[model samples]
Target: MDNKINFKDLWAKQTSIEPNPGDLLLQISKMKRSNLRKLIVTNLMLVTVSAFIILIWIYYQPQLVSTKVGILLIILSMTIFLFAYNRSYTLFKEDINSKSNTDYLKELLAIKSKQQFMHTTMLNVYFILLSAGIGLYMYEYTSRMTIFWGIVAYGITLIWILFNWFYLRPKQIKKQQLKLDDMITKFKKLNNQLEA
Candidate 1:
């Protein structure tokens, strides 16, 4: 019996095969892209709201100390948001440009991890500054209701920071790092196969 493999048939069979590790990595990358998009949109909204508040303060209470302080806080928040927004955008673009699958996957995961850390840090900083600014405003305005709300807001922000640090961030980082390691192992296996 003569045995001969048809190249086209083999190619078609391979194409029809169920997706494996590589496809999963691509799916993860797409999910990351979507997540980054959502983050950018949310940051834009925050920036817009902050700008609106500053505009209102400028028009209504240009000379008020509380308004001035609010403006400063808004500016600080915007700056932090901008840093995260721009870094994420750049990383997304770079990931899109990467031609090698393994390299792209590794770089994308690193970028995502870094972006998460930076985003959290910026948010924590913004909340802390917000708490201080709000507290100052309440004290200067001499309103019991304002002071109560400010304290509540500060408490909520502190709790958020604690929850993120203790519960969310560590788990997220570990998950991402595990994914990256798996991808690396798969890549090494593929390389070894090619060598063999």
Candidate 2:
């Protein structure tokens, strides 16, 4: 006579642990904060750059139609982009955790869709317009410079823009999308568990 227990029985006796609802909300809040911080930094940089360019146009008084047009276009594009970015964020309340899970998920899904549209369509157009605007704005200024200096200026600008477009932009989009998708998955899992 031996006291023997099967592995299945031992497993059955183990207590089930569910994810803490509060913890989930906290994690979601952290993600939202991080995203907002990035957006703010980006927006500040844009505003600074736009202001600097406007000042240059005002002070230097470049005597070319193209320069004026370029400067105006670049400033316009920057303003538009910044406004759109800020407006989209305004749709998102500060504390997503304040809402019920169903409501939170709904809002999150809406955010995901808006972000996708902005990243996929609006941003690319903005980039193109900005690039063209800069090229135009610099045309008058660079025309007076030596070929080497002009190339250097445009080359540096192009490289920076390219890096943002090809590298940073994609990385950010992927990371954000992953975070949202992961959170959505967890929410679904929790909902299912409740239904069960």
Candidate 3:
């Protein structure tokens, strides 16, 4: 008839507990598959857009040297980004046959490092090249419009770029960082348990 709660029973009955190794591994696998799918989709979309741009260039046959340069810059930026991004694919491919947790951890660390570089430096370069390319490309068409309309067009473009840079980019980076960090932390816990 004692009213006092038993600490042992309370602890034992607690529902919130750390994920088991099998569950953790399953989650990691699922995340990996999801990430791989996202990577493929992103690459495919970029390639399709590049092809569309090339088709437009061939069909429209822009006369201005600036227009040609602009198109080249856009395509070059996409190519560079894709190349950098795709290099990480090897890590995913190799991870399947990873011999040990240590090897998998190493791969995860390498991926995190690469993603940091992509999120920061490579992304900045891509955005800069894209902005410059768009500006140059728009000149040919905008030149035929009234000054006010030209200004409006440029302003709209600038605003859109700014919104993506200041808002969307940070949000996306944070989201991805959180996901990777969670997986890394969980993997580290599992690794420590194995080591101990």
Candidate 4:
């Protein structure tokens, strides 16, 4: 008896190895829904924190123009980011009705474009605005603290922001892009199979 592996058997198995198209579409839907849920939760948390900060600014009624401007900037940045984020969520939620794979692919591409924009240019603007706003806001508050403690507090905040901007953010962006790319690839494959 020949000990050689049956290449013909392997080739035949490969032809039947395709995942069910229905299962794939279901998986894509589940991924989209999970992403939507995460976005909503994140937005809610951010909005809550921003509202708390704004309330503090309003209640204390600080006389410092810099403080006022800083608070406003912080609020503005949060609002702008949330608006863009919600818009992205809406795009993701729009239509999963895979009437044709082409339509589904179009929506996925749109989301990928928006995700790229959010992670790149928007992320930079967001962090910059947030950092500057926090720094300016701290100007008035830190004035009440001892010099050393004030410096320490500011140092910690700066380091945290820098870490997020340089390290965490890129990792997050790459992970998100990879997830989207995987979904896109799966859909494209399904489309090819359907057409075939």
Candidate 5:
């Protein structure tokens, strides 16, 4: 009777172990890559829009002549570009690299969740500020024609707020929270294995 344990069998069992950490990291990394791509695309679009607006303002410099209002719009557009630029830069700066597979997965999840939260909060705050700024501009620039432009600006602000509330923010928060939950599950499993 073979009473001695076979090292070969133990090795075989270990070799067949599931790659849970690796699989999760791969999934998370893929999601992050897609998100990064989306951010880049959005930033590019914002920059392009800002540039086009500036060009239009310059080209029609004579007719649409309200130096203060034009200046305010230009500043507002630049601010939007700056916000988008900063977000993209931060995302790039926080790219994930970890010493261990477990650490890598955890860090990646943390960074992604943080980024999502920061973006949603910043966007909401920005839209509120924008709405307020537009309202002030309309108040200051009131005239027969100002009514039409004021309504247009207010409409744009309302659309932005509605879009963020109905679409962007909820989606971002839900996705990030789901990722966080997955990471917590993995962490708990790792802790259990260590305790065992």
Candidate 6:
């Protein structure tokens, strides 16, 4: 007599859990709202920071042309990033329930494409501009310090930037991609079930 049961056989015999379309749509709606809120907050923060930087520029009135250029670059980077980020705001504006599965899927695909662009090209541009700006901005102050302190300051800043670019950026991109891919996959499954 066989004492061991066939676990694979049992697993195969069990009915697959089918996700209800309504539930999926509800969850997607909730996710969209959450994302929209985050977007708004992030945009506001960027705007606020940009305004602060502008105030500093006006108040301090940096002497070197390079310092002014650095400030401009930083502001420009933030502006460009904000513009690209705002493009996704349309996804949450309409009622998800009003759209058919096909339409929703198309919209999701468009979102994925836009996300890829933002995560890759836009992020790279932003980081590059930001790094250059910081490097230039630090130059004036660091020059005033002793040689050792100047080197230390630049080294620390470079390390921080590198950490963000190499570590934090990829981690964030992966997290965003996974979340979006999960929703898309769930929707696709629901779509296929409907067609079948």
Q: Write the per-residue lDDT of candidate 4 for residues 1-196, one digit (tens) a residue.
A: 7769897897887655678999999999999899878988989988998999889987998889899888888887788788777876676566577557677766666677677777666767777888888889988888899999999989999999889888987887788778877876776786677667
Task: Give Cα-based local distance difference scores for all models.
Answer: 0.66, 0.81, 0.82, 0.81, 0.64, 0.84
1-196 per-residue lDDT for model 6 (tens digits): 8959998998989896898999999999999899879988999999999899889889988889888888889988998888777866664565765788777776766667677677777878888899899899878888999999999999999999999899988888788778878877886787677678
Error of 1 at 160 (Å): 10
What are the per-residue Cα lDDT tens digits for candidate 2 across 103-178?
Answer: 7766676676776677556676777788888888888878899999999999998998889789977887787678
Q: Count clashing residue pairs per candidate.
A: 0, 0, 0, 0, 0, 0
- In model 1, how large is the Cα lDDT of residue 156? 72
The estimated TM-scores of all candidates read 0.51, 0.62, 0.67, 0.66, 0.51, 0.69
Instruction: Please rank every candidate by TM-score, starting with the best.
Output: 6, 3, 4, 2, 5, 1
Whose TM-score is higher: candidate 2's or candidate 3's? 3
lDDT against true structure, model 5: 0.64
TM value for model 2: 0.62
| Model 4 residue pairs with clashes | none
The residue-by-residue lDDT of candidate 1 on 28-114, one tens digit each, is: 999999987887797888778778877776676655577578667756767776776677667667535545765655565566557
The number of residue pairs in model 4 that clash at the backbone is 0
User: What 10-residue stretch in candidate 5 is worst by lDDT?
Assistant: 62-71
Itemize residue pairs with steric clashes in candidate 1: none
Candidate 3: tens digits of C-alpha lDDT, residues 17-45: 67798998999999999988989898999
On lDDT, the candidate that comes out on top is: 6
